[model samples]
Target: MKKEIPLAITFISGVLLVLALFIPHKPFGNLEEIFNDWYIIVSGFTFLLGIDSLLGYNFGKLKRKEKDAPYALVLILSFFITLTWGIVEIVRTPEHNPFGPTSTFSLYFYNSIFIPLQATMFAILSFFIASAAYRAFRAKEINSALLLVSAVLVMLGRIPLGQSAAPYVITVIFLIFAVYFFAESAGVTEPKIKIAYILVALIFVALIYPLGFVYFRQHIPEFADWIMNVPQMAGKRGIMIGIALGGIAMSIRIILGIERTYMK
Candidate 1:
């Protein structure tokens, strides 16, 4: 009964929320807003839970004389420093804001730590991309070879020299390379030469006219705008619906005290 009741409530609430989207009446229309407020309150508790968990784990490690004790110490120190700084800044500010120009410690932390860490995180992505490309562009198979060629052409097409000299040609080559690679990977053709020719024709037709029109328009026009707008929005909506349902299920479990994992 513990599990069954909560599960039933989850199912009912989820269905009601989904129905609320189509039928926008009083109470139903306000459902999402009420849920949003509930989410904010839950999130505050979750943040406290995270802080408690972090302190417990780090303090436990420190007591046990763990191998990475120094790192844990550093993490704990940094957490406290940031927390204290934030609280002080909030209290000093006129309306409990720590972001004013007068907040020296806030400005110092933002400049010294936050900005550098953000930059370092973004810089790591470049190394990751290089590693992935090295593993992917081995050219052991026809598809890999086509992918390598398309990647090279696309890189070249982005250059000022390629754009000025033969932009259409470069664009067409990249497109054909992509299509051929996709087709070969999908097992559409066995003959490499025939596949290449078909890819070339597809690229020529797709790029030549479009490039000419864009050149005349003198502005960057999106070719896949419909795909971006319609399909992408639909996919996002579906994902959000799934997320809402999952949240409702979890919330029901929490409210009914069915999920005691938190207590542990």
Candidate 2:
């Protein structure tokens, strides 16, 4: 009954929220606003749960005398120091906040700790990309060769000098591929070879287009503006739709207690 009641509430709430988007009238609109407020309140409570879990895990490691216990202690110490500093600053000067100029305890910890950690994590991903690319290009087949060539062109095309040279090179490359395609269609080339060539050529074109557009933007602005507004906006909209659906799914799971791994 506990599970069934929560699941029923989840399903009903999900449908109403989705429907509220289409009907921008009276109670529906008010209900959506109420839901938004509820979400904010729930999130605030969830944040405390997150902080408790973080502290608990780190403290457990310290208690067990784990190998990485020192690192966990460092993290906990930093967290408490930051929290204490913020609380002291907030309490000391109610009339004029000590953290007014954005040089506060919270901001300092975020800039020093959070930003650098995120950058370090992202930088580490480059090694994985290199490893994957090395594996991908090691195949000796025609298709693999084409893939390797396309990847090299893409990497080259990303650089400043290569991008500058891409427009002239792109035109010649396209013409060569077009001739090869026509020849294959007219029975002058083998089907397999033609297919490989066409695939490589299309990949090259895909890489070249961005470079070419950037190059052309120095001479003509309208084309660049169109690419940014039309294609980029379409891409953004697609991403937003995916994000909305993902959030809805997550919310449903949370409300129904289906995603209770966090509690553990």
Candidate 3:
């Protein structure tokens, strides 16, 4: 009966909310706003539950005298300290709310401690990003090779001397790849295929210096901009559309009571 009642409530609320979105009439029109208010109230209680869970877990660790107990203790202390400070500020100086930008809490804690911590976190993430990029940009195949080239161009476009240096860099890369392919062609048993490969490599190396470096030197940034704005934007929009469709499908499943994972 308990499970059935909750499931019934979920189905009714979800269907009503869906109807409220499409049909903004007398009954359904107020459902959305009412649901939002209920959500806010429910969220406040959920936040208290979250705080209880966090503190309880940390306290358990401390009680066990674990190796990481000190770290947990610090976390517990920091939370209470910050919470007490905010409460004290609220009572002591009502005009200067703790949430205000110019308040003591914002200036001392948020700007001084939080911002630097955030920057440090991102700085650490950059090394991981660089490692991932290095792996991704390896010229394993034609697609990866294109990706490497596109990435290089986009990166160079963003920098000050990138436009001028891009041609030379790209020329050097072409030469290196051309030499590698030419070397590979020497081991090929098929005369026609070997000759074709060698000719293609030689032709590419030959054309890069004259046409690429001379004529297209000034247009590197523009070409990079085109790649970013056109191809990148199209891919991003497609991913976003897929995500929206998935969310809609999930919402429908929940509304129909087909999704019962949340009951657990």
Candidate 4:
């Protein structure tokens, strides 16, 4: 009865929510907001459960006199200190400043402790990013080499390093590739077309106009920006579509009661 009741609720709720998007009338109009409220309430309960689990685990370590017992103690002390401050603020000055500027405890802990800890985490993350880039940019394969070059150009173009020249450089590279590809194709097919592409490439390389550097400075960033915005955005959209479809399929399975791993 317990499992059946929850599964029935899930199926009904899922179906109604799906229909609500199209219906948008009466109870359906506010259903999404109601679900948000329910989510908050459920998440609060889950958070309490997590706190209980943390306490149990840490206390067990302390009781066992583990090597990391001092760290566990520090964790418990930090949690209680923060929790006590929050509870006191709620009871004493619930109508205080929105930014909590009035509460010294909250302000000091957040600015002096929290901000540094957050910054330290990000500082640590930079090293990991470098490590990932090292692995990705390894010249073991043609694909990896291409990826490395593309990444370097993209990164440099966005940053101050390649601001004035990246776009023109990238264009030159594209022209070279185009000439080579057309030249190779011409060996098999029409000869005149290949000659035209070669001449076009040379002309682009040799062409000179007054104040060309000034023009390039303005256009280069825009060209580099296009590379990121167009091709990269298309790939992002494809991945997003795949994720959405996967989520929908998983949700459908849960609604149909085929997904019951949690019940195990």
Best by lDDT: 3
What RMSD does model 3 have?
2.4
Tell me the spans in candidate 3 whose CA falls farther than 4 Å from its real position: 25-30, 94-96, 102-106
lDDT of 1 by residue, 1-264 (tens): 866666566667766777789888988988888888999999988998999999999999999999999989999999888888888778766564666556788788789988999999999999999999998987788889766754554444455554444455546555665565556556645577666766665665676556633551232223224444576579899999999999988867765567657543
Q: Backbone collision count in every prediction?
A: 0, 0, 0, 0
Q: How would you encode candidate 2's per-residue C-alpha lDDT over 1-264 as one tens digit per residue?
A: 756676677778877877788888977877888998999999999999999999999999999999999999999998888778877887876664544555466576677878899999999999999999899996467678566645545544455566455566555555555555555555527777777766765665665556455554243234434555676679899999999999988987876667755442
Residue-level lDDT of model 4, residues 34-128, one tens digit each, is 98899999998898899999999999999999999999999999998788878877788888642477787888888999999999998999899
Looking at model 3, which ten-residue stretch has the lowest summed lDDT?
209-218
Candidate 4 colliding pairs? none
Tell me, what's the RMSD of every candidate? 7.5, 7.7, 2.4, 5.9
Which residue runs does candidate 2 get wrong by more than 4 Å? 95-103, 140-143, 163-264
Mind giving the per-residue lDDT tens digits that candidate 3 earns over 167-187?
788787788778988998989
Q: In candidate 1, what residue range of length 10 has the lowest lDDT sum? A: 216-225
Return the top candidate by TM-score.
Answer: 3
